[model samples]
Target: MTAAVRPPYRVGIVGCGAISRNHLEAFAALPEAVVVAVCDVDADRARSTAERWGIEHAYGSVEELLAAGVDVVSVCTPHPTHEAVVLASAAAGAHVLCEKPIATDLAAAERMVAACDAAGVRLGVLFQRRFWPAAQRLRAAVDDGTLGRPILGHASVLLHREPEYFSSAAWRGTWASDGGGVLMTQAIHYIDLLQWLMGEAVEVHGHIGTFRHAIEVEDSATAVLKFASGAMATLSASTAASPSLGISIRITGETGATAELSEFPEGTDGRVTIWARGGAIESEQVHPADVDPNVDLAAINGQLIPHHTAQVRDFVSALSANDGTGREPAITGSDATAALRILLAVYESSRTGSPVRLNQTATQEALA
Candidate 1:
């Protein structure tokens, strides 16, 4: 393959908010990126964030931002607006970096993907947790067969939210805006990791309930995932836990080699807490901070961004190089469809009391 030309990347922001700050910071860290414009439905919020970030223009809609001459966009809007913004971005000839839970359903996700594919623009989803250093090492090990055949894994998040949290926003728990409560919004990171490591889940059986928070959706969820590779996984996620808890993931293999990863506050930003046994590093132990987690808007070469920055780089590279790999490793719009499919299956299985197959089409209540 021939090397692609390199230059500073011009970027735009759509739906500026808390998570959007991370995107702004990551982009700022990259010398190749210049964040010039932003768009949001709430003009005040857009104006406020744009001013704070020193962005030159604030757009009232996705179309306006596209007209501002941006090369790519970071989508931080609610789940419901994902398709609209992504399609607009593609049509505008700008690449996209969308937030998690791509869309509420597989159909919307497929539409977003198809739009980008037809436009010949790249669509990247933000799964920044993958950039964690320890995760990199662990995944590398798994890919190299050092962990032997994968058996099963467990991922859980002990996070909590108050009753006021649900009341804080109209879309907080609604199936329309935020998608499917804890599973789609918060546990998605863990879900992505589970799929990333163990491969696609062939079946999902879940038990869901609203144990604490009063919302339009389930506050707690536990699922059993059976992968095509015969590897199994159990996911436990809740917004009802006390004192907010971090995330933990454990991967067990047939060779007795096991790897465990975790997240902690004030630490482990781009790193994974690791534990391995009965393998090459059985006797060795490492901390997540050993690799250092940086969300502080710092790029390696002052020319590339960190965290979601990789997605941005891949987007630009894909546009300029026509390299298929540029878009593959990054999350495509359609990939979110697959994630939504699994989530909907879990919900369906929980409600109907049966194992839901991945190949099965989503039922109408899949949205509810």
Candidate 2:
């Protein structure tokens, strides 16, 4: 007789913060899963989220949850602590879905990936923009050769923030933990998008500086990139811009197909447009973001929330198939390594007043 199928999957959450809420919503919506545990240094924060989510298990430390029973763990903690959490969870035999940047440093990012490999667990970093509908349309255009090879693509995330945001979070503006100010924390989505569209960058030259906020990392940065395809791109990110901040990426293919996302897919209440040659293309492919009500204004933030659920689902799928295994690690922990490598190069170039070269994907072993 065939064995009965198990229900969805079980999940445990680490960190309780602005982004964790979105992860919770995604977990709640899935029929195949249960949020079996919650962890946070703040007892109240962890317990409160557990109570609200109807989860009976709550722990003050992620180490405790690892000791408890958890099939998977979400590393939604502070930027500085991601590496440790992911490694510990991977060691505990739980696949992990870590937030972006993987870690504050390229080294930490590599360690997380390597540890996962040694532990035989998958590590998935969140880069939800890959699933955006408008993004899909653009990707289609590029793939179809409508953009004529995309000679260049440009993307930027510029948002204004009050000073309070910098000082409010204990580690917000510091170099040791918060990583780079805006580029690492806020605009990383666009940075990942740039790589997604243009392929890995071969070299980069940039200008980085801090202003408008009291952060050790650059509040602003701009760079010129040379891709393996011989294509070029201009990338910029900042958190000090005035209000009415814009999030967009314009790609110019050798064939002259241009794709533009004027509004941030996360909170875009406006329409997205695709222009080719000189005419506007009809139809917007973006689906409803499907964000959870738990997050304010899910209509906008829904994209991230919804995609993360899909991300977790992918995580579970991979775990289920090991050794000819379930799903080959959906998004390898190494993807984060690549992104972080480029980010560090950008910073290095900005710091040295020189350009950095990245002719190929950085291997985890090379990093080792």
Per-model C-alpha lDDT, please? 0.74, 0.74
**Which stretches of candidate 2 lie above 4 Å from their native place?**
1-7, 264-266, 269-271, 278-303, 320-325, 359-368
Worst 10 residues of 2 by lDDT: 291-300
For each of the candidates, the C-alpha root-mean-square deviation to the true structure, in angstroms, is 6.1, 5.6
Model 2 agreement with the true structure over 181-257: per-residue lDDT tens digits: 77787667777777777777778888888877877878888988877777788888887776525577888887765
**Residue-by-residue lDDT tens digits, candidate 1, 1-368:** 32233346568899876578778878786677789998888988989998998999998888888898887788988888888999988888877888888888778888998888888677778766777777777788688886665688998777756677677667789876777888988788778878888776788999888888778788899999887777889999987876555577888876678887766431345244455665455433333344432222122223223656666555555656554444353666655666777788888998899998888433434312
Q: What's the alpha carbon RMSD for model 1?
A: 6.1
